[model samples]
Target: MFCQLNKTKKRWRSMFTVVLTCPKEQEKCKLPPEVCWHIGASISNGSWLSQFLSVFLTDLKIDQIVTFLPLPPRALPLQELVDELYNFRDCYFETHGVEEAGRKQSDVAKEIEKTLKKLEEKEDHFKHKAEFLLQKGRCLNVAPDFSAVAEECLSRAVKLEPGLVDGWNTLGEQYWKKGDLIGAKNCFTGALQQSKNKVSLRNLSMVLRQLPAADSAAHAKQVMESVDMARQAVQLDVTDGTSWYILGNANVSLFFSCGQNPQLSQQALSAYAQSEKVDRAASCYPELHFNRSTLFQYEEMFSSALGGYSRAAELDPGWEEPLEREKQLLEYLRKVTELLQNKGKVKARRLRTMLSNLSTSALGPCSSPEFRSPTGRVGSLEPRTLSSLTQGHNAGVAALGKVVFSLASEGRMAFTFGMVDSEETCIVVMVYNTADSWGVLIGDSVVIPEPQVKRNSITHKDESFDFRSIRVDSPLLLIVNGKKQNVQSQLAASVSYKPLSE
Candidate 1:
């Protein structure tokens, strides 16, 4: 005899029909009334019937019938489930844009929380529970408003698994987001103690750069340390764009905080280029674009600076900083353009009189006549016209110009003004780290020694500009009206650290 089984499901109910055929008769055979069984209820509740059929068919030597029976589903391992959830979270984050990522993260966080709740019932899944908590915490950390819960979850995770480096790093990030620099620093340091990983190293490098230092020397030391740590992180993972980006930021800090080293700026740009090349996602990072824009602005690349700011704003629509920066840059350019347009209004007699009256005699003790020549020999250095100064750093050259128009201060750090040199060449002068007390008025004789010059031309939107400018890092470097600016007129450098990304 041969047996055949047919099954069907509707709603929650399942029906199974079995037929037995006799080869000799070539017809279906009915089981004895005592042997017949009828099972009813939902498929989930029909386990007993399934088990009975398996044994009953095997006993009758009907193996083909037994093969059709359904087996109970096996439970997935907790570790595997956790891994899948993490993968799902990461894939969702990557696929969504930054603006939409927050909402998506909330959905992912709910799934992770559900998993965590299930894990709580299984005492053996302690490790998996900690991992879930870490994942959940990281997800929530992306949105600043969720920081409180994120911190709680991260804290619990670290408490459960003290050696979890990622937990520590996420906690550090949480602290950093909340502006608790000391707490963030400690968390990153703790993560480093566990292992010298790229994430912790790069984060530590960023924190180090922002840490408060007692003096300029101490600040320089911290900045150099930041650079060293960032370099180590890059060495640890050459392909990690985040590390390269952090290294770029550290170099930028070194350039601005320490002496304005052009080489350091170049190094920063190179690092950023490497980051962009290695990581396709670097373009989505607003911080990278914003920082690069700041550097471009410093380098006198106005068009590139504007584009960078615009890109950064596009990447992070809610962030107003890039927009504010773009506005300030446009305003500065407009003011400069207006000043340039009215350059012809100043009479030749007044210009000549101002140029002739420009004297360094008032510089007195602040004047440095001896400059190191190209051969490294100290010699009498003669002042050159602004037009004669070469691009980049004019190391041994000096220039004298009269301030013709004072522009509005950009941020609280720099005072910008238009200047006309002795040769009738007009230029822009930016004196950084100056106090409001050091008034930079129009027609004031300004003597700059060892001026750093950048010849820039910007054609942005409806405005076009072509000019050469001098950047003086400190007011002490300027001799105004024959009197050298004292340290009292210099503003102490303020610390405003940028986030790793937006």
Candidate 2:
């Protein structure tokens, strides 16, 4: 009985909705009132009354009978009434018990293999079954995973019917889903060439919109023209949200071609804003919200940007942007709190409260304050010495000493040198100052370019003792050979050379 009802249900769905009636009446069923009511009561589980008539034909309740009789075609035969009631009951059974039954039958692979075998036989009766397998493959490809079998199945369908838009759309959508933008573009382009339907146009437009600018401006221009054609196809059928979206994108391309001119950018923004106005919520398109979020970011509207990211995630929960943006904002908030706390303007108690609030709000509730002791720590300013200079040495000198400056990491060194006393002494001086050079490491090397000279300031005096070191007014990089060295100690230490060139 259940199987018969299932077959009937499928048949009913395949044809237009129908009513059972007697051929002699040409309109109403030939069944008697009592019999009809009996039929209704059997199907009474539905809104009909066949079973009541079956049990109580002698009862003269004409008004009641009429009330139960649905207008003519709605009136049912006893047998047909029983069948529908059973079918409705089967629906309830499936709803409540199917999941448990399905859980027990864990050999999904076997079932799928059976279906695939049936599909390979090219049986027309199982076309829908074949299509279902193809659809399952398409779902797996939502991440754009290409399986040789899945592509084969979809292509087979396309071969069977060149005009089946679903096959092309599915193949193209698979490429689009997998982030193969070029593959998606090619497939969609092919789909468009094969069919000019609204669905195909919409898919092609979406792929085109995401494409980066082509290297050849001519190709880019051609692509831009295609965007317009896609937009027009959609506008012809505006009920779908995607058509308007394509139009918005075409306008954006036009705006982009206008370059950085403020007017053109505003126009692009306006176009995108129009796209945003369309009810994208009706369709699960995360790109809609993602694009809006980008525009908000450009405008420096943080809250709006976050809101866009959040909405995109809500539409497609797997999206990572909203979660990432929230994390970045929290990190930024922590930095801001640290900057405020370091100012030290508040009373100690107030400062502690503020810090606590910052920790709670920025780092979340589980955070604890970590304080460092000033006694044992030195930060980037202690002084140390390098080797001392010799009066008659040919090479440059190095000096080491203890910290002198407030921010000194090492000791300071100062030396005064001038020409040795002689009646006809000619003073020739050259000093190479080293600063800002970073040290090298294995597998990594640093390069320091010679500094450019901006100006030369030379001074001369009669007395040798009164003469000072020639100060080169320029930035100098201190390097240990080819690589730079870090001066962790901030002290005033300099090396001066008196030329032995003479």
* Clashing pairs counted in every model: 2, 41
**Per-residue lDDT of model 1, residues 1-502, tens digit only:** 4344433335325444553433443334464322322231222345766665565567667444222122344344555556566556544536776567436646676877776666555645553567767766765564444378779978999999999999999999999888888999999999999999998888889888877889889988998999999999999989988889889988988888876678999999999999988877776677889988888877667899988998887666667888889888988887776776665357778888877877656334334445444335465446787768899877665677788887764653467877887678888788877777776877788877777888777876677778777888788877788776788888754435555452
**How does each model score on TM-score?**
0.70, 0.40
lDDT of 2 by residue, 280-354 (tens): 332234455555454444333445555666665554454565556544533433332333233213344543443
TM-score of 1: 0.70
For candidate 2, the 10 contiguous residues with the lowest summed lDDT are 400-409
TM-score for candidate 2, residues paired by index: 0.40
